[model samples]
Structure formats: structure tokens, C-alpha cells
Target: MQLKPALGAIVAVSMLAIVFWQQTHLDPKAPDAEFTTLSGEQIVLRELGGQPVLITFWATDCRACIEEIPDLIALHQQFAHKGLQIIAVAMPYDIPSRVKQLSEMRKLPYTVALDIEGVHARAFGDVSLTPSSFLIDRERNVVSRVTGRFNLADWRARIAAM
Candidate 1:
């Protein structure tokens, strides 16, 4: 019986470590993944040089993903004019119709892409969690990789540095 508590503690600590490890998983170069926008426009990630780009992996069914929508929308509205490109990439398993419906319902000001083929996720380091964002610098270097909900203050700092 005592072993059960110790084992449980180990699992909890391991889970926390995994989260931090995933959060720090940054790529040397921003991979070029082509995204098809909801409007049917094709956007290439690598080609978007000289611009700070945020590629966010999200899913319609994820509560955290849903909660981050407003923050992302505001961020897009604020920095988009300053050459920031925010791309919300829906996870492969998320129902496409629901994703589209949510995108329309939220009135997302930024581009929303569906990674139905899992290519986008693979390109962005096999992102398997909702609300993972890769902050790519103007030079196309992935400066930061954030997993989980975004922090407004942290976002401002990243944007200011860009």
C-alpha cells in the first residue's frame, strides 16, 4: 500500500518533467509547412521570411485551445499590422467541420489552417498538444516554443523583442 503512494508521486513528477521538456523543444529553423487557409488560400511557412510568425497548434475539442482563442485573436489584431503573422493550425484528429465552425464562430482575425494530413504537426516538431505555439523570428529561427495556454505578458515581451 505504501508503494502505491510512492509510485504515484513518481508518475506526477515524471509528467511535470515531460511537460517542461516539450515546452523547451525549439527547432533550429522554422520548418516550411504549407497550410491551406479556410478561405482556400495556400500559405508557405518558409517563404514568410522577414516577418515574425507564430504557428500555433490547436484543436477544436480542447478546452485550453478554446480558452486561448480570444488571446490569440487579440494578439493578432494588435501585432498583425506590425508584420506579425499568426497561423492557427488545427490538430489532425479534430473534426474538420467543427474546426471550421469554431473558426467562423470566433471570428478569428488571423489565418486558420487544418493539419488534417498531420504534415503541419510533423513540420512543427510533431506537436501533440493543444495550444502549442512556435514563435519564429524574422530571420526564420524558432526563438521559442510554448506548450499550453499563452501568457499575455510573455507574448508582449516576445513581440517587443521582434
Candidate 2:
């Protein structure tokens, strides 16, 4: 028995839809979500309660996002001692190994989290594009959000004024 090309395509598409539907319906957030550090230790958000946080959503494949990483590293170094925490949330994609490799290669001093289910993205407001940043105050309230490539000078100035 041979299947026609159109029928084969339809079956393949239907299977793909089912897989996407299942994955999409799953919740990505945990009330107690704990992120693993580069050294493989898990740390919960509540642990960093007293410090302001800069959360950036990015993907390994995003060129524009990759370009801002060095600046982010600079910012982290400059403000970490000032009670500021920088968290890079890696968007869900097929590049966990690559992300880890890059993080190590860059020698990132800040924490990194994997958005395996996009829960962070939705909870923080679906930052669909890469390099989106959210500035959360010490109280965990989002004070500012920026999408697309950003200027480090402007970001630092805003945080300094806060």
C-alpha cells in the first residue's frame, strides 16, 4: 500500500500540531521555581529578595541579542556590588548545550536561567523578541521594560537614577 504525497504531508502536519498543542498547554512556571547556576547549584528567586534585578530574555540564535551580552556583563560587574542582580533567562529552544557553552565562554558573572517552558516569559509578560529586558525593583515589582537592542549607557543611567 502506497500513500499519496498530499496525504503524507497532511499526516505529518497533523502530528506536528498535536505535539505543539501538548507542549503549549503545559504550564512553565513554578511557584517555587529554582534556577540552576553555572556550577550546578539551584537557587530560588526568594533567596535574592533584597536586591534589584535585571531580567533579560534571550535566545542563542538571536544575533542582536548576542551582541548585547558583553554590555550586560559590564553592567553586571559595575552594579553587582551595588545590590543589583542580573539574571539572563534563556528562551526555550533547541540549544541548551550551546547556551551553556556560550555562558561559560563569556565567563558570565551573573546568574542564568533556562526558560524551558516559557513560564518566565509569560509571567514577566511575553517578551516574544530576543534581548528584551525588565528592571525589577528590590520589591520585585517591574519598573521598566525594554524590547529590542538597548544602549548600556542609557540602561545604566536609568538604574542609577532608580
The candidate maximizing lDDT is 1
lDDT of 1 by residue, 1-162 (tens): 899999999998986787676656656788877899878899988788899998899998889989998888888888999999999999999888998899889888899998889998877776787788888899998888878887877987898789
Q: Following a full C-alpha superposition, what root-mean-square deviation does model 2 have from the true structure?
A: 8.1
lDDT of all predictions: 0.86, 0.74
Residue 91 lDDT (model 1): 92
The runs of at least 3 residues in candidate 1 whose Cα sits more than 4 Å from the true structure, single-residue gaps closed, are 1-11, 20-25
Q: Each model's TM-score, in the order given?
A: 0.89, 0.73
Model 2 clashes, total count: 0
Worst 10 residues of 2 by lDDT: 23-32
Report the lDDT tens digits of candidate 2 across residue range 1-162.
Answer: 356988999988986665455345433322234666546777676676767778788888889888988888888888888988888889877277888998888888888878777777776555566777877776665666667777788889977865
- Judge candidate 1 against the unseen true structure and give its global Cα lDDT, from 0 to 1: 0.86
lDDT of 2 at 105: 87
Query: Model 1 clash pairs?
Result: none
